[model samples]
Target: MQESQSLLATARSKLEKSLLAKGLRRSGERFAILEEVYSRNDHFDAEELFQAMHQRSYPVSRATVYNTLDVLVDCGLVRRHHFGEEDNSKSRYEKSLGRQQHAHLVCTVCHRVKEFCDPRLHLIQTNVGNALQFEVESHSLVFYGQCTDDACETKPTDSSANTEDSRKTQE
Candidate 1:
C-alpha cells in the first residue's frame, strides 16, 4: 500500500509538470481520473474508465475520460495496448509509472489479459540489438491463445486435441 501511494504521488507530480509544460489547466477532474487509474490493477478501455468514475460518485463526461487518457498516454503515465487482431479498434490502457516492462498473454476466448516478466526476453532484446547494431529502447510482445480457466466462456471440449490443433496452426 505504501509503495502504491508513493507511485501515485510520483505519477501526480509527473502529470502536473506535463500539464504545465503543455499549457493545460490543472483541473480537479484530471487529477481524479489519474487517481482512479492508479488505483486499478487491470487494463481498461476509456468507456470502462468513464463508467468507473461515475461508479465512484465522481461524474465526468466520456469526452473528459477519453481526452484525459490521451493526455496520460502522451505524458508516459499510461501504456496503451492493442492486444489482438480481432479487437484492433479497442485499445486498453494501464498505468506505466514505476512498473517494469512486461509481456502480455491474451485469452482469445475470454479476452482476458495476463502480464508476465521474463529476464530472458530482456536478454534476447539486448542480444538482438547488439547483433543488429541498433539501439532497442523498448519492446512489446503479446501471446494470444485460449485460456484454460474453467470460467472461460469458450472452453475446448478435448484439451489434448485443442492443444494439438493450436500447435499445428502455429507450425
Candidate 2:
C-alpha cells in the first residue's frame, strides 16, 4: 500500500508537470478527483464517488468527476468496467496504476468487486491479437458471481436489476 501511494503521488506530480508543459491550465478540481480515486481502496463508479465526495463536504460536481475520470482513463491511469451482458449500464471504475491486466469478479447480489490478476489471461490477449492479426486497443473482462453475504443469497432471482440513475451534476 505504501508503494501504491508513492507511485500515485509520483504519477500525479508528473501529470501536473505534463499539463504545464502542454500549455494547459492546471485544474484543482481535476487533481482532487484523481487524488480521491488514487487514495480509495475499493472500486467505485462515478455516481458512488459523487455521493461520497458530497458527504465529505468536497465541492466536486458529478460532471467534473466523470470528466476527470475520462482523462485518467485516456492517460492510462484508471480502469473502467462494464459488467455482464444483460446490463451495460452498470459501469464502474478504479485506478490502474501499478496494477496491470487484471480481471474482475463482481458479485451479482452485492456488486462487490474482487480483482484477479492472471498471467495466462495476459498471454491469451497477446496470442489472440497475433492470431487474429488485429491490433488490440483495449478490452474489458468481468466475471459475475454470488457474494458471501447472506442477505445477498436471499435476494429474489431475476428481479429488476440494480441500476445507477442519472448523476445530478451542474452543467
Candidate 3:
C-alpha cells in the first residue's frame, strides 16, 4: 500500500508539473481523474473510466473525463493505444509515466493486451528507420495472435470477419 501511494504521489507531482508548464489550471476533477487512472495498472477505455468514477460518486462529467484525457495525452502524462481496429475500435489508455518503452502482444480472440520489452525490437526500429531515411520518433509494435487459453484456441478464425470488422471501423 505504501508503495502504491508513493507511486501515485510521484505521478501526481509529474502531472502537476506538466499541467503548470502548459499553463493549465489544476482542479479536483482533474486530480480525481488522474488518481483513478493511477489506481488501475492496465489499459482502459474512456467509458470504463467514466463508469468507475460515477460508480464511486466522484461527480465528474463525461466531457471532463474526455477533455482531461486529451490534456493528459498532450502533456505526455498518458499514452493512448489502438490495439487492432483502425478507428480506435479498441482504443485504450495506459499510464506512461515511469514506464519503459515496450511493445504489445494482442490476443485477437480475447482482446487481451500484454506488454513486453526487447532491445532487439528497438534496434530493429532504428535500423528500419535509418534504412528508410526517416527519423523514428516513436513506435507502436503489436503482434496479434491467439492465446493458449482454451477459449482462444477454440475461437474460430475468419479472415472475412476481420475484413468486415476493418470496414466497419473505417466507417
Q: State the C-alpha lDDT per candidate.
A: 0.93, 0.75, 0.86
**Model 2 agreement with the true structure over 1-171: per-residue lDDT tens digits:** 789779879769866876677666679877777778877877888998888777778888788888777777766777777776356786678887776777788887666778888888878888999999989866677788786665675554443332222222321
Model 3 — TM-score against the truth? 0.76
List clash counts for every candidate, in order. Answer: 0, 0, 0
The TM-score leader among the candidates is 1
Q: Which residue pairs overlap in candidate 1's backbone?
A: none
lDDT ranking, high to low: 1, 3, 2
**What are the per-residue Cα lDDT tens digits for candidate 3 across 38-106?**
888898889999999999999898899998988878877789998865456656999887778898888
Q: Highest lDDT among the candidates is held by which one?
A: 1
**TM-scores, in order shown?**
0.89, 0.73, 0.76
Reference-based lDDT, residue 79, model 1: 95
Model 3 superposed RMSD (Cα): 6.1
For candidate 2, the TM-score is 0.73
Better of 2 and 3 by TM-score: 3
Candidate ordering by TM-score (highest first): 1, 3, 2
Which runs of model 3 end up more than 4 angstroms from their true locations?
86-90, 126-135, 151-171
